[model samples]
Target: MDGRAFLASLRTTAVTRVEAGERVAQVSRNMGVSRSSVYEWLRQARSEPQKLQASPLQGRPSALSPDGLHDLATALLAGPESAGLTGRLWTRELVNELVSRDHGVSLTLTSIGRLLRSLGLWPRHSLVTWPDGSARLWKQRYAYIKEKAREQDALLMRGGLVDVGALLPRSSLPAAPFGFHLAYALIPGGPLLFRAYSGPANAATFLDFATGLVAETGRATCLITAPHPVFDLDECARGLAGLPLTVWVRSDGDARALRPAPAPATASAPDLRPAVLGGPSTGLWTMDRLAGHLSALFGHPVSTGEAEVLLSAQNLWPEGPLPPVLPPGSPAVGRWCHDVLPLFQAEAGPGAAVRFVQEVPLPGGRTLLLAVSPDQERRFAWYEEARYQGRMRATTLADFTRRLRQDLAEPLCLVVTDDSGWRSRDLDATATTVGDAFFCTWADGCGERVWRIPERDPVQALCRRHFHQGRGPAPAGTASLEMEHPPRGPVGTADRQVRIAAAREHARRQPLSAGGRLRELVLAGPPALLTTRTLTALLSRAYGRPVDADRAVAVLRDEGLWPEEFPSVEPGPWEHETLPLYLAHAGAGAAVRFVAEARLGGDLSLLVALDRAGETRFAWYPQARYRGRMRATTLVSFAGLLLDDANGPLCLVAADEAGWKSKELAAALARRPVLVVAAGVPYLCAWPAGCGNRAVMGDQCRTHARRSRRLAVHRARSGPLLDAVRAASAELAVARA
Candidate 1:
């Protein structure tokens, strides 16, 4: 029977035993099952006896056997290249082809998809890979340090250097900013220690702080800091020598996992209720006055509405109803209903000569003059005039008014304007010469007559709409008339020529293919890596149509822009040796650790050793150096340099990998008590207190492989789920509005 049938048979036996007068607890113990499970089986047998029976398996059998499926999964993990596919990505079609060629099983695309999902494989867009087992390493190192601190009865602290300029409030910043500050806090509810320094953080400043820390502690203390350059300098090492301090510099990933202690409570502000209620009864308490008073007391900006809420919470309301807040606009908008609108309506009779004018200053020393007539057959004219040195000439306005009168054939023009610049004597005289009346719209608070323009003037609204449409992309089969030639008047001949030349050049260029354009963009900029999703978006924008990512990849591949293989290094033979060694060295008692420079793909080149107590300590090079090349002399020099910082004996180990099979490396290590061994070494599993099995994969044994696969699937699905949730929240907010 299969695994599922075996479990069903076991459950049926348990229920049968319980029905034969056997105690549920005793049966559970005998069968190594929980009492709850035995009771549940009994209940199931009473209600649905068929559930306890091991029925024959249903459905069609899979085309591939178990070993065949395993081979396909291994091939998929090796990627599409192993199947002789031409592209890096694996679609259902590729997987189907691979299955047919390898196992002689011709499955449909849907079946291939089911097969891939069953093996826990999914499509990814980007090429970046994260190290596995980093979280496991972090937990192990953290627990080791905490145990060491507890045994020594030393005060444990966790902190690092920070840029004080970034953390301080704007009001507290000095006239000239200084950058670095050292801050450490005792863990599990202890006082914080902070020291600020001027200028950037350097070896000298760090050494000074270390001296002060030694003097202040005067006893054994364990301080954990992030791996920083200042701590590794020779000056810092000399200054910290023979001190009663044990400093541990953790990797960036591990250091970020440390949780900060809760901060002490800040002193509360003095109560302002007595001061506000005792006096200030001479006049009504306005919200604006209260807001200003509260802002001063709290030392931050506060609005009138916030002040009203605060006062209401304290059982203090304003004397009367608050004034309604006005909408943001020009001052003339307030008097539009009562002042100037009636005059315009009175003049809008049959054959009336009424015109609305709007003057807007634009960037690049230019002004837009727009005029519109309010009638069923509305007529409008606009002119863009370039001013010299930002000064508007009266002649430009005169010319626009003359053109409007001639175009509309209105003899007596009465124009309404809001700009105070219309009060120019030259403009008024020109208007009088043309039999036109230019009325200025300004509402003075007096018992006299006033004229003001409405907030949404017809001419200004039309001008804004026209400008916005002009900025957008033109529709297909449509062309702008102004592109061929510049508008008449004011613009110099040289400027007109330049505009025409630019338009001609833009028209002469032929459209490029999506692949060609994408290649150009990739070659032009810093984002050297482009995912399939990013490629689809870029190509769709370039071609003004939706382009599928698979199609884009095909086109780029045909053009030799994309490679057939994914950008990843194959797992080298040394990773198995390096990973276990690294984990072994990361245990409780090692005083210093060093990692050799070797090419161990998928993980950093790490070195691990065990002392007499069988405790492990680990050290590794930077993750970026996983694929980097280093000479034997370079490795030996670095190892010698790290020996200066070692508090106890140091040992180096060589693997059977190609990089470690060097005569020079072996000779150099022979000078020290280093061991160079080949394969067949029995190493413990990298899992936390894992089963005593030899590792077959990178660092995990076969027992924990299924658990690791489940965790990997969970990590893959979590990111997309979080992104979907955030998108839904934003969409909900927009819908509510």
Candidate 2:
């Protein structure tokens, strides 16, 4: 029953009980009204005799006539939205507006209230529930994206459906609280809220969601419906300033009559930051993305402003943007020359130098001839059990030591091929003494073996000296093995690192330059390795002397290795600036192909060979950079050499800094504009037309410095016509009388 009918029945029961001699408390219980209320009604009945009667406010005329009242009740029952209101809730003002529109009766909110009381209808703010069909529509929208993305290479296209829902119960009145929002995004991970945000959702929630959608998906689209009044999508579209996000607001329940969302206010910054919102470039409580995440997590909508407040209060990023991560893949130590520059530690291949192959430097003028060969067992294998089957070599210790001692004389050792299945026959005897020869069982990776002969006992070395030797393919039917000798000379971890760099340096300077042609070779590489250390290391290894690394950088930059506009992107783990991992693992031929196909722009240019050095002087203006020059190097080294005309001419010459350091090369260096004649590394120097950009002359620098020091000399002057002289590191600034 309505409030009026219920009140009337209570009055009737209370009056009847009072007349029947029942007490006020008993009457109150019977009538379900307070005792004072029953007493007041009984007194009114005794005095006026008609006050307890319920006749619907008899004698007073209702502002909304019975017909108007009936129409208002009908309109409210049909919902405010049906009667042309913003939302589904009812209010006195909304009822007033409804009466005027549907019944042609202008009534005040106060009069509407009285009419509502008479018709068993009381005003209330309706509870907010998940919008009808919103979730299903949201899912369907995402499904559509997935399907369309398949045709579009799994990319999120612009102008797709976006749905956001957020629930915020009012602390004061949760039954019908004032907070509810929609989750907004077509992406799978929905908008999320900052942790510990229990307060009501607001504009910030939606803002946060929208911002994330624009950034992550690069989508500019939205869907609007009439059920929610606060979300004015056309007005909301202004947030995505730089993106192409388009907002579509549903109008009149018709598909074609939709209103387009408004454009953003101004242009936004470029999307140069990382993919995630909480990256270092982004704020701790980046409102837009936070809203999106929270909405998605809570299965409700979160606004950008709501998200911002929560985030601002607490820290979202305890650390900076996460390091690049990749899926786990492992087949440890396969090729020995792959990632981490493997061939450096233990050398056992053909053509390796005698020094590199030896187990250690024999004490005081002692020498040992060691055999070197390749492990063809792992020649075609990359990693793990797949390639490890045939790498083991079985041999008894006693038998091997007998052959070594027989072949070599006193103070000589034999490093053999015993990578696998080599162990001491008896553990009790650590060192086997046989006829003044000490034999210790030792093995290394890639099927390499070693036998040590210490002429003197109690070797004072803690660990073995790490060395690599051997080179070139073996003769018919033989493995290309180098020195696989083990010794007692200790090599620490730091020393190992330094030696690894040195090994790569040796290979790059020697083997990489060993190709047939020099002048026509073009070295196309990434700009990342055009630095001082790498170039100096190259020349030093090639020339076998210390070349100033800084001078090398200056020369190569003159040779056109300086990238004008360097592009940067966050690299994944096991990655480098100039080279892709796939290319890094591939052979030299594959690398050449990759660089040729790569449409590099900005500073990432191919090193071109400009001129071949003449017998009398360095090549007259080395002005060309190419890609064919890169050989026998890891692709991720960010360098390549080429000799193709497909790209524009790059004036860069690659040469050993030592070779180009003569005084005669200066004449050639003075000729070229935008000249890049690198002393050590290919495509790593720039000696432009003027001295405005520094040029590093390898050997010529010392000669020039001596000359400059002489030219810099000047006559001394008596200070203030008295007794001091000057001209050390200063100029005269002479004033003539």
Candidate 3:
């Protein structure tokens, strides 16, 4: 074969093989070529050049060929309405079903999609329906109306105003699928005004629209609309009754005004029209922009958000003057209400805005400015509770206020509290340090209260509770500092003894005081002993003071001497002595026993073992799992254990059954996560395992054991020697278990 012809044949074979999902290696073997050569030829065919098909062999066609299916789908989609179908769009399944039913052409759901793509009749899945009407129709109608208005030489200027009556739609917004109707009017220079009425729009809605319209333009004019019940005489009278603007309502055969008509203008009515005004029916967005436009029209900047607030206030008290909530003779506070009060209530909740005034220096020199809302008072209350009652340290109110003043860069004014506490004041205060006096209130409280003591310094501020004393109330005065008696002796042994006696007397007053009599009982006696000596001491000396049996028991439990079952042993000579002690306990019971070694002079080593009663024999290990597999060794001292290479070499070969069940690691570490329990008070600690020396996984684990020989006297007094022995015993138990 010629080289070019050979290459063309090879290319065809490679493409066929790839389509069959056969690997290059398999293809290479079948084609009698090296894998690399087959891959190279395939790559060349794909990237370098197109191969010529010898006979242009078209493979066996499907029952319905691609082109044939395309024609069928196109015919189906041309217009389902022609066939009296209700749906506007054709789904894949629908098209397939239609083709099969009409032409007896069966097509798979997947094949129908490919066929549709070929005909360019793809599905349009998402069609937005607007509050007023369908999005497409709205855009079309709006564009047409805007164009016609422009053609009539009526153009709205940036700052111009237009009295927008209502563009009442035939269908109620909510009744339709879209769920809202829009009312709007063209403003000359102001923003486009639109109000969304959820139900059918009528005269009341129109009146609302007109009132808002007048508030924006500072005057009202004739409202041109189509014949609708909203403009019936009664409805028109209701809407125009008390409005400041002269509402000349015009429709078919009905036109009237609140007052006598003015003389015909000397010239024709000024060409006042709108350019582009598009928004939802709520009119919130449109009104906001309109306010800004009004400001520009009048040569001053007006905030639409601000105008909305004022408009809301007017609506809230249509007939009455502004509310008298702000105290008399406080114009700064009153001015705060002009925009902020309504805004806060509308955005946050009712009764949420409270203004505060602070004197400040402006470009005009020293002046008093109102720092409206602040959360200090509420914050102070919380701080008081936590610091005194809850015994927690929290930031003070004064500090928070001072920081706020620094942050807002102004004397700091009003604050709005949205119900988050403590940190709320801090957040609000941060705004003031930047130098603008603004509104901010505590997160917990709804409104602001005037700063009672205006003075910043806590000390200089007069106490509201006791004005005559002329003092701040913080840390209220306590009992007299006067001593009943002087020191009994000079600074020597006698004085020290006196102090020690006094301390003991104070402790003896409370049965459950940390160093009191109850502690002594739990540390020294069993539960029965608690029923005897401890109870008697408590009843006689400190019964009326405070009783905490749990605390006392916890102390003993930490010492590994608490009675798991009551009626425990009395104190012995080795009560607090260190010894070569082996700790053994039954899993089902909480009692712990320490068996001392027979060897003398060597301080007792601490070792823990498991009880074998009913599967009670302790499975001992350095880890906290109860493993069945066991390994044993002799005990060693703390230093000796550390020095041993066998201990160092011990690593996780693999976990065993016994290792998984063992609780030794947990007990040895003395760490327990919080859990729910029944009956007993939560014993946060596990057994005699004290929260260990070092924390593991964010918790304390392992016992504290220290070895030092710095001072012989010190060494003799501390239980270090005993601790070493205990460590040795622990190592021995781990080895044996």
Candidate 4:
């Protein structure tokens, strides 16, 4: 009964009992109601307003009025907070509370709930909620989805189907909790078709199924699928020529239509409480709907339910996960389509009018009807026995019938060359040994050779079980035969090296000049840029040809194969200007200190050492200034600041600093002339007579001191100047000795 009528009946009973002066418990028992029920009814009667006894409030809205109730329900469903409420989700209790506090109208908790139920507003599990703001981002970030759909549609118009697979939320599938996917494709004649899979899905597997379809049917406008690094899209640009791409977006129900009513409120419905109300992306269902709308625009019935099934089937089937293993697109599934379509065509061969069926697993672990051929029942009866005896390897009923068709095409008949013994009999047919075995099974229920067969001839029972009683041409010869082997070349180091060298030479001749090709012969990637250490690793396995690091380095250098300049630098106080310092003193002195410092650091002065023989030149320079000021100085001082080494003259080359790297340093060094540094010391000449006569002075300073010493005695003045010169000369001689 309606809640109001039930309440009114209870009130009448409660009043009658009270007027009769009856006890509450006795009255409750007589009325077949609980004491609480009776008490509640009495309470309702006492709390009733004078509306029944007098005039009702004019134009006052009713708490349970159809219009007001619908408004409240609609607002709560949209989002509770949108109705000026505190929470995003509405609980029945919360809804009741809001209604009772209406200021002018009030309702009982029971009445509020009854009103909602009457208005078809019962509570339900929340639908899958995608990121709140994804819808906005989709148009910008997911334009690819539309582009792919359009391409797919265009292909379908020309008689093609684009196969695709995707993982969608359970709400989208509404079939299983997890592992379920959506497999879909576009057909020229109509909209998309779909199936489901409850397992792992990969690009290769998806492509394998596509290949089957293509090989079966020669009908495809274009292939389309969600873009994946491995599947729909190629990892390299070279693999993308003449290819199609797809886009998969996460969204809720179609953005264009109403979603299914929230799942019925029950223990079975899972709670889907989102952590945030409005976030980055909208729900997957919404995106799915948007995808559907796009698909629909292309004259395809873009359906959410169909999309879910399509993705699921691709994942469940074998070979669907192994994408690109066949071809870039689903050429395999396409092949399957090509093969099957012909068999069903009007011009198909005789006995080709059989039915086809597929056995597929349901989402809830149940096996159910998927597809069936008109002749499936008759077809199954003929092949079921052979399938049971292990003569056929068909797992499903439909598969069994397919195997039977193959058998029927080539029946295991006894070919009699001379019909002499009981020509009317269908038995004792003459044929080859293996063919005879199969013919005997057709006539005698099983091949007859157990007792007469020799033990060494393993084909005795194997031929009967594997090749007998099936449709196919018989083998040409007996089983006893030797296996043929492919030819092999002489195995030795010299031969392998010859092959490798030839391969390398061929690679070098290629127009691209890609180092990767040469490296692939020895290792992988570019080989020319490899250091001696890396090169040694590639040659380590060559027989009898041991590699000495020093010898290898020299050999490569002599051949101009190894980098002439090691791209390394020493730690030095001389900054980027280290190269110029070394250039300033380009004679013999550059050898002793340059060798020790460069080895201790990295090969920093490579450029300076290259031009160190005779020319006095400098190139490397540090050009940055502090504020508006420029501290111009000798190259040596500038080198000291740029490099880590303190005592050495600047080299025209800046080696990579031991602890620092700068493009500026490299760019500055690149402008210099090449120089070589030797690892030896020069013979010392006699000490000069001035500047305290330090014998082993650097080249630039040594010459300056010798000139100054020669002129010092002659340039002296007569009195104190001459006396002072004599004293300085005496000190210089003493310091030198």
Candidate 5:
């Protein structure tokens, strides 16, 4: 018997003997076990006799030995390419081949799957590819911080600043018109020290709070704070000189570790009982009573403004009518509708144009200026202008107005804008010089409408919605207003051509890197599929590295490929009618096409094709079974299935690596024009004269390009550590640059 069964048999025998009225001591002596063990066994037998039963033996031994399994795991970690596999993904067939080749164990695909599962390995779908050493670096940093905190017996605290205006009553907000900044330091499971200050949150306020905290605690404080401009490290170090304090700037990975735990519920100090504060004869709290209560609680003379802020923080409202909650910009909107809109309407006469101007802030310090006429035709034009480094200047508005004037041929134009920045004296001077009337009005709650234009034309709403969705072209009905260029004549076309040439020259000078390729694609046109995921996949394939979606977007902005603005519209639930309309459009055989491509990897096959409209479409399904073998359907069959109801002749393109070589499928498609073309494999690396491995970075294979990148990061991180170590050993001062 196995060792487990033998032990179980002994336990069962001991329990039987003990239950038969024999002394526990005698049973233990006979069995050579302790009396306590016999007694425990007897008790277990009385409760659950099945507890003494032995567990069943394991199933038959695995086909591969333990050492072979270990080697298999190591191979998996090294990736499929390391084992001479074609693709990066690990499939059952690949693992079976790996085991048969390396371990000399020929296993079935099913058996290989079982073995992989036993080793705690499973197939996962992830678009993000994390760096190799980032997790290890994060763990090391966390361990170092924890060790230092433990050695110094320091209180690990996190500091934050909150705007008091968010919690204060609207009536009291004017006392600190810009809102009072409340700087707070929180000790996990300890006291919370906070102070209210005026003006913007800056380094001086943070330093003052930290200094006071150090003075109060008289203990070592390790503060974890976000890397905001308010926490300038050099300024903080100088301001907190000779204090037992250390500041750590938090990184994205360390957010969870630096998050403060909830403090204990038990009160650490005397509670300020609000009921004990007697009110006036009317039983209402006056400002004096509230201020006096706060003064006593904080042990300092509290002003009325401070008391109001404190009352709001504690959610203590005086007995009175509740303040009405109005939507943002409502008052301004009301004023504009009552007073300013009429003046613009009166100015808009025959041959005269009234354009509602809207300014949208975009990524990368740019602004989009849109001017749409209020008339039924909805004549609109937009201009993109770069902003100054810090703020929007008058020159940007002037340039946009100039461009608008060149586009619209109307002699007299009245421009209505909601942007307060248009009220600048410089902008007014420019408006007077251009002879364009500028009227600044208040925007509506949605910010898309100053006057209710959507109610007049439903097409305006649809266009705005499509632009905000950032999906397809503006719905079928909407059209851009075309106008003849002003008598400036041939200059416009020449200027545009010159600009295009300049852009081409700039692109030519740019190196053929991932960013350069992305810029080129964007310059060609705004991609039909502009989603982050799609861009990430495209860039990853082009660059031969794991590119994150967010990183792709950031690159677009940095390369000036991103648009200055897109319409902002809140998404609504999909209407029931949308699906039917989409299917009918596709069924008409005018909007979509059928293209078949061979599978790249996995059980599923992918078919990517471009439609007649030049928009990319993808269709995928499990590889079809035909005569006991996997085969894709003929192009004729797929076209008929997709466009069965259409009356027109269907156009089908069959592009595959090998599957479409059948003469029968070719003959079927021969009734019409057939073009057979060979396409390169897009999945492989594009690097010239390099190993055609899977690309994980930009256009280059990971094996050939990522090694240098990893080394560069390692050197950058290790340089500081090496310098500190050498300086400490030689007793030399290390100057930081």
Candidate 6:
């Protein structure tokens, strides 16, 4: 070979020898080159292993043979629908299943996707966001509508009115979506005038359409409509300046006089033109949009997860005799007619939309097949009739299982309740036997067991076992079956009994009017707002027995726990302590004195004072000898019959100099003769009452504050400690002198 060939041959020989574990010395000797040459050859081979393996040999043969690829690509190009797939889109799992069935070789979704990509097929999707009145600046536009509705009604009532609006959905027509704003005018008794332009629902298009409609309608015409871009702006207003046309934008739900007809040009034989109001149906989408806007005005606004209880609930009240309960524009509250009721009664029933699709009928009634479905927002269950005042949310397993299957085709099994930790015995059930499928019940809320049914796919079967596998109940378990699976009476019976017992005892020990007691319960509560559930729960715990929420509300209302009306007069600013400090100084157990109205031989009702955030109580001044005490019963009525006419209102004065507000407190005290001695000081008050609901003194959490005095000094003073000190000082001084 030539020199290049010889060098290449030598390098190959050296690299092969080195890689074969031959010593560098042996490789160099065999190749007739230096040891350095062998090392260099090996290093090149190691640096670029790909180059060493870069022979024209085939890599692992394609998973599919040439024929298989040809056939597979053909099948895919035909589209998923042609292959009998349920969904329009070709998902990876579907593709995998299809390929496995056709080729008799299972391929993962990932691999099939790669094969499809090589065959030049790709996936496409459609995405959309719904457009509505709730677009940007909705609040501003809504406000504008509310303000201008009256003017629009006047214009519409005049004669020739042009109403403009965009059609329901965007279309794929040349203009493509955000359909044209159409200005249609039905002149009373005259020819119908209409104009349509394809484009965005914007100010420019609106102005153009309005101009065209005005031209067709002639000089004297009025256009009234919901506020849109062109109509609401100054530019459109300027465009109509020269014309005899007036534009009025309607406000939300503005009540306006009916538009009277204008005389036709000749009234020649009925002008057989199409009437816009009596035209073909705008279809469900348009009606849905109408319902949405109307509902907002009627208080059944479009919000996610709200239930449809009645037509008033959805605000789809049509043109008919309005339901007796519905008041004009307002939807009826807490009541609805059945005709307009929603398929989902969750909002009406206070639970959520649930489906008990599969049913088995018996002479008794029907039984429901349940499968656990996870939902984040609502609690759904299948039951027949709601139990007494029973919350739709709260249901027994028996009831849920007994609901007659409403829809038949569903094959899903119901999974029990979720992670509230507070489980209802009825909602939480045991492993039940229903047909071939075990209605499995497991206590662990963390694991969700769905699709555990016998899987045809081995891979799917393995996954089923992996996810649903969990520990079963013990053969010798000591779990509380009685609590978990209670016999049918009512739910929460034990809880109610405990609560009733506790509450009755507390009420007997400390009596207050029913309403007052409930108010106190509400005021002293930890939660900021009281819901029936929370209140009922609270009442149950406080008293012994079941606390029905509706009953509690009724009791509170009856008690006239109404706020006291403050006298039109405002309290003048004077020395005063708020709740905390007031509770401290001149508080309970503090020395107090009541001053008399008359300077000489007057009646002084000295009493111990009690105050709360809402109300105050007074008792005989502690250690008042024989003075009578005041009771909580007459707290508001206990105004001083005599000394009440104060320089201002009788002030709550502190006896201690530290606690007292000013010299006014002392001067006022000196004016009266009764003296109170407490902790070596005296607090004085004329005991004015009926100022506010504060009597309305609270105790429970706030109603949490209860009165008690500070800790007392316990140490005894030495009899002669002061005298002994003085004598010692004198003796020491004399000795020093």
Predicted candidate 3 versus true structure: per-residue lDDT over 566-654, tens digit per residue: 32223344322311111111122223322111111122112222112311111111321123232122122211232231222111111
RMSD of each: 42.4, 39.8, 31.8, 35.6, 38.4, 35.2
Higher-scoring candidate on lDDT, 5 or 6: 5
Q: Against the correct fold, how does model 5 do in TM-score?
A: 0.19
lDDT of 3 at 141: 48
Q: Model 1: per-residue lDDT, tens digit, 354-469?
A: 44453444343334444433211122222345343454456766665555555554343344433333456777422211111112111100111113223443111112223343
Candidate 3 residue 635 C-alpha distance from true site, Å: 37
Task: Give a tens-digit lDDT track for model 4, residues 374-474.
Answer: 21121111111222333222243334323444535532212111122212233232211111111111111121122232234322322233233233433
- Candidate that would win on lDDT: 1
Give lDDT tens digits, candidate 2, residues 1-737. Answer: 22344355557656776788887764553333467887788888889767676556568554654335434544544455567775434456667677777667787766765665454333132222223445556666656545544554443422222221111100111121111122323322432211111112232333444454445444434333233322332223334333344333333322121332332221331231122232222212223544576677556675654443333233321111111111001111110112121121112222222110111112232222122111100000011121134432223333333433343344222222232333434421122111111111111111111233223322211112211221221124221111112111243322222222223332223222221111112242322222234556655533333459555444334333333442222233323332232333232323112112111333233422322221111111122223532222222221222212213222333332323333434344343221334322211123222233222443233345455556555322334343334552234554431
Number of the candidate with higher TM-score, 2 or 3: 2
Worst 10 residues of 2 by lDDT: 375-384
- TM-score of the candidate numbered 1? 0.17
Total backbone clashes of candidate 2, pairs 3 or more residues apart or in separate chains: 113
lDDT of each: 0.44, 0.32, 0.33, 0.32, 0.44, 0.33
Poorest lDDT segment (10 consecutive residues) of candidate 3? 169-178
Question: CA shift at 692, candidate 1, in angstroms?
Answer: 6.3
How many residue pairs in model 1 have overlapping backbones? 6
lDDT of 3 at 502: 24
Supply the TM-score for candidate 2. Answer: 0.17
Stretches of candidate 1 exceeding 4 Å from the true structure: 1-517, 540-551, 564-697, 700-737
Residue 167 lDDT, candidate 3, scale 0-100: 17
